[model samples]
Target: MFIFKLLVILTLGYWIMMLGDTLWARKLMRQLPASPKPGGSASTESFASAGLAQPRGTTAKELPLVSVIIAAKEEEASITETVKHLLNQTYPRFEIIAVNDRSQDGTGHKLEELRKWSQGKRQVEVPLTIIHVTTLPAGWLGKNHALYQGFLQARGQVILFTDADVLFQPHALADAVHYMKETEADHLTLTPKIVVNSFWLSAFVQYFFFALSLYIRPWRANIDSQHKHGMGVGAFNMITRQAYDRIGTHQAFAFRPDDDLQLGMRVKQAGLRQRLASGRTQLAVEWYKSLREAVQGLEKNIFSGFQYRVLPAAAGVIGQLLLFFFPFVAIFVLDGWVFWSYVLSIVLMLSVYSLLIQSLIGKIGKELLVFPATVCLLSYIVTRSVWLTLRQGGIHWRGTFYVLEQLKKMKR
Candidate 1:
């Protein structure tokens, strides 16, 4: 019982500080200007009407060219829509390069068709190039390899790496370019808006983001003093061609599962400027269709985030159990004074949890109500992620089975 009390005291103190952090993060997120539909908002509107928006003091001719690259393995469901959105981007001095990475589905055919249409019809003002990879070499991960190929062929001053499933509003690229120039960032990643199809699953993503905010503190990415902490997003990652080359490019993170995140970390380590922004209006993606899929998607992340080690992963699970569920577990098992202490702790926890839910309302949208009830479900997902990763000995993504030993060697 004394042990429980000491743990509770520590947890409460930690969470109280976390509660303050979450609130500050919420305000920072709220301050981010949401890009509304073309001509809907004052700060953000149609690219056609606004013309090419250059940096505050720069002229139109001085704007840099931005190249957008997308790598897809089997993204037939969303690739068509995503490509269309990319072609219609408001950023005038930009090109799009879409890579069909050894896809078995109709994705390869679809990209070729899009390329031919763009060439013949002159539907898009910029050049659209497509590449199809036939094989994966032993040293490289498929998506990273695809991106590197695109980078090699990219001719723009700025290179954008994004997922094939992410949908961009007409002004998304323009907004990113403006932000990058304004902040003078060498690398920038914007968090995509959650396209909520499953209420509970979307809630978990929102809750997870807010929970991670306590540690990641993404809003501070642009602060010069907080350069040690870096943040990234797969939906949108824009970096200067020079920075990409300086950081060792794709070869730096050849086989890592958390490649996007590692890229951000590398950039920070190189003493470069990096920033993170919200894409609530400009960018969005259907992350998962169902709760089960969400669970499966996180399998590699939990373990990879912990460096594929066991003790740290186990500590994370145990920490979650004690920090969030201990009071409930003790309420039924304890007696008298200890029981009342447990009850008080549960009330305090609920309050902080409630604050986290409110902070994420803008992120998940419409399905925000499902968050407060999904804490236990999220915990189970974490435990299961650790279990699946250790049980399988390594990750199996797409068709390749990355042996643990090979990965550890590559990581070295």
Candidate 2:
């Protein structure tokens, strides 16, 4: 009972911290410039007046070629929509490089169809290069290898690396370029708006984004250089070619599961500016189908983040239980003011979670009020993930079995 109380108290404290962080982030975002879509009501002069003009060193006549590269492996479910959205982007003088990494589905065929159809009736051609990566090198991860191939093929002043599932708005690329130029950022990553179609997906997404928001706190990424860390989202990483050349591109992050993060970190460590922002309304991605799928997908990231250490992974499970689940368990064991206080904390927790969810995704159902239950659910998922990783001896991502020992060494 004492332990439970302590847990509840700790959770409440964490929530208070998260609340402050959220408010600060909101304030920072409000101060930042908003990138208007081309043909929108906001004129170029208005953007300049709003302090959201194009990069200081460049004009419309000298716009650089931006290459958008996607690495796909068995992403047939959403690749079409993703590629189509890229084709619809308002950003001019850009090319799409979609690499199909030995897909078992029709992803390659779909890319071919889009490329050919767009090329057949275009004035200056669709400018989409569909590369087929049939061989995965002995030591490289499939996705990383495909990305390296795309990087080798790209010939642009800017590179946009993204996932095959992410859908960009008509002005997504345009806005990103503008932001990059304005900040003179070598690397800029925008967190996508997660769209959930099912109840379970919504719950999982809530937990995921809440954890990410608490951890990342995007607002402070550029401001706090003392921490000296940076993050990149696969949905949107706009990197100048100079930074890529300086940091060795995907080769710098090859064989790592968290390629985006490591890449961003490398850019910052190299004294290159790395900016982060929310693409809440400008971009969207349905990350996973269900909690099970999410857990399956999280194997690499969890272990990689933990440096393949079983002890730390187990501790994470314990932390999740205490931080998220204990308040509910405390109810049955306590009484009077103590219990009521715990209940109040629970209300605070749920309210914070609901607000975060509403802002990040959409509305939540009454069924989701049982927020503490999700903690217990996530505890199980995380525990199972650790056990599965140890049992299988490593992570099996995209038909490749990466050994645990090797993953641990990757930390160095």
Write down the lDDT that model 2 would get.
0.75
Candidate lDDT scores, in order, read 0.75, 0.75
lDDT of 1 by residue, 42-68 (tens): 443334353544324444456688989
lDDT of 2 by residue, 191-222 (tens): 77787677766776678667665655555557
TM-score of each: 0.88, 0.87
Tell me model 1's lDDT, rounded to 2 decimals.
0.75
Candidate 2: lDDT of 160?
91
Every candidate's CA RMSD: 3.8, 3.8
Error of 2 at 165 (Å): 1.6
What TM-score would candidate 1 get against the native? 0.88
